[model samples]
Target: MLHLVTGHAGFIGFHTACRLLERGDGVIGLDNLNDYYDPALKQARLAALQALATRTGGFYRDVRANLADAAAVDAVFAQHRIERVINLAAQAGVRYSLQNPRAYVESNISGFVNLLEACRHHGVGHLSYASTSSVYGASTALPYSEHVAADHPLQFYAATKRANELMAHAYSHLYRLPTTGLRFFTVYGPWGRPDMAPFLFTRAILEGRPIQLFNHGRHSRDFTYVGDIVEGVLRASDRPAAPDPAWTSAAPDPARSNAPWRVYNLGASAPVALVDFIDALEAAIGKPAIRELAPLQPGDVPDTAADTTGLQADVGYAPATPLREGVQRFVDWYRGFYKV
Candidate 1:
């Protein structure tokens, strides 16, 4: 199969692309390579993809373009025989969204619409896109379920992600497009986002700096490992969404629709305390972290736990990586990559 992977130079995208290539699929990667964290890291990921492609004899081509550009997206569809699409490109930080809401609007909203248009026009079979656990905003519910209503988004980032789900549903309903949105929970592992907690904590601990514990170490998260995330994504992509036969408009479930659209949580289903996660990192690095407990930042959720039962039932998805092992793998990669 030929796969079109947006944000291919990104953390998850890079891993996903490599997995696809390894499975003997031709992949075309698209990314603007914006300096959201470090352009060097993005470049390194791209280089690694190229090397792997050369070694495996699997075609891997990357196009430098923004998803917001309709012409660019259309051109790619027109040029390649793209069978499936994995849309991972977006302005990705919750705090960053608070600072610049426009970026979220441009990339997450406008860019997603462009991708939908291209998919509808082209003969794309399955369109799998990244949604966020942030969409479960302001809901005090533990073990957030896909059937629950997510109308109250606390941050602009969550709002945009919710908007994407709505937009994809519309496309699926109108065009019979097979679209699946995966609501990813606190994803972390090697090559993780630099802005995320795992990377920040690892860097601070290695450099002998204090690690800030938000909400004074009271927060909890379902930290899904990146490898598990990539595996779930691939499984979901292979299984194109189908309209639920039991779906009824009178009592509609938010997770499934009468159209060929669905949403599932990709998470570990086990929420770990912030301090415990930090301790795992410290153990991985063999160094104790200088603690700096601080007040919770705005647009941040105090806790998140994923109800992945639906994902498991549908795709047999199960996250198998233990937190300690995942943290150790990340620490090893960080040390090797940064020479710390």
Candidate 2:
């Protein structure tokens, strides 16, 4: 399979691309390598991918370009015979959206449309894109299900991602495109984003700095490991979406449609409190954290628990890693990578 993966230098994207390459698939990786967090980390991930491709004898091409550029996207499609598209690119960070709204509109909305247009024109077989558990915003439901209506988004970032689902659905309906939107829960692991809690907490603990606990350590999250997430992505990519035979217009399922479109929540299906997760980190690192409890920030949810039954039923998606084991792996990687 020839796969085109946007944001291929990103945490999940890099891992996903590597997995595909290891299986002897040709991978075209597109990433702008922006300095949103640190471009150096992105570069390092790309270097690792290059090394993996060399070692595995798998064809890999690293394309440095922004997804917002229509010409660039169109050119890539014209150049390569792309069979599938795994779009992991977007202006991520919920708080960042509050500060810079245009970034989300440009990357998440406009850039997404460009990809959709290219996919429609290029005859791509299947398009699997990343969504977020944050899309379940404003819904006080525990164990968020794919079947529930996710109409309300708490933040602009979540709103943009929700918009992506709607946009994908429209394209799928109008052009008969096969699209699958994977609503990933709080993901963490080695090479994780520095902006996330795991990385922040680990770094702070290692440096003897104070780690901020939002919502007074009361909020919980379904923190899925990156490896598990990549597994689900691969499985979903292998299966092109088909119209749900049981779908009906009268009681339209939010996750499925009569068109070739579907949505699935990908997570560990286990919620761990912030303080307990910190405890896991402390155990993994053999050090205690200097905690600074703070009130919940704007656009932050109290908890997120994924009801992954839909994903498991559709793609046999099962998250295999335990939280402690995953955190330990991450801590080990952090120490080794940073020479801490």
Candidate 3:
């Protein structure tokens, strides 16, 4: 089977693409390689994919274009029989959204609509896009479930992702397009984003710099491993969503629709506290961290947990990597990748 994986050089995207290629599936990787964190890291990931594809004799093609460019997006669809799509491309980063909301609209909102249109027209079987746990903003509920209404989003990034889910639902209803929105909880593992806490804390500890503990070291996150996430993505992509026959407008479920649309939380379902997470990192890196406490930043949540019951039911699995084990693997890769 051939697949189009947007943002294939991204942390999760890189892993997902590698897995697909490893399994002997043809892959078309599309990435803008923006300087979101560091294009160097993305480039390294791209080079790695190139080498792996060559070594494994797996079909691989890389396309460099922004999804916001409708012409570029259409050209891709016109060129290839992209059977499945994994939409991981987005202007990610919660804090940055405050400074530049337009970037979010251009990429997250517009780019997504472009993909939806292409999928609707091209008869793509399934499109699984990235969503986030931040959509459950201002809700004190523990282990956020997809069934509940996520009407309050604290940041523009979350709002855009929520919009993607809603927009996908419309296409599913009208055109019978199959779509899945994965609401990932604090994913941390090898090739993780530098802006996230795992990378920041790991870098700071190794460099003897102080790592700031947001929410005064009390924040907890369901830090799912990248490998586990990739597994879940593949499973979901292989299974097209079906209309929930029991769904009704009068008593609607936000996660399931009468259309061929569904949303599931892809997480470990095990939240680790910040202090404990740092401790695990220190142990893995064999170095002590200089700790600093800081107040919670805007658009930041004190805690986040995922209700992965729906994910397990649909995909037949959930994230299961242990925190210490995953952190160790990340540190090992960091040392090798950066020679630190």
Quote each prediction's TM-score: 0.99, 0.99, 0.99
TM-score between candidate 2 and the true structure = 0.99
Model 3 per-residue lDDT tens digits across residues 160-254: 99999999999999999999999988888999999988999888888999989878888998889999999889999999999999999999999
Ten residues in a row with the worst lDDT in model 1? 205-214
lDDT of 1 by residue, 100-201 (tens): 999999999999999999999997999999999999999989999999999898899999999999999999999999999999999999888899989998
Q: Per model, state how many residue pairs clash.
A: 0, 0, 0
Poorly placed runs, candidate 1 (over 4 Å): none
Q: Which regions of candidate 2 are displaced past 4 Å?
A: none
Error of 1 at 196 (Å): 0.8
lDDT of 2 by residue, 1-340 (tens): 8999999999999999999999999999999988899888998999999999999999999999899999999999999999999999999999999999999999999999999999999999999999999999999899999899998899999999999999999999999999999999999999999999899999999999999888888999999999999999999999999998999999999999999999999999999998999999999999999999899999999999999998898889899999999999999999998999
Q: What are the runs in model 3 whose C-alpha is more than 4 Å off?
A: none
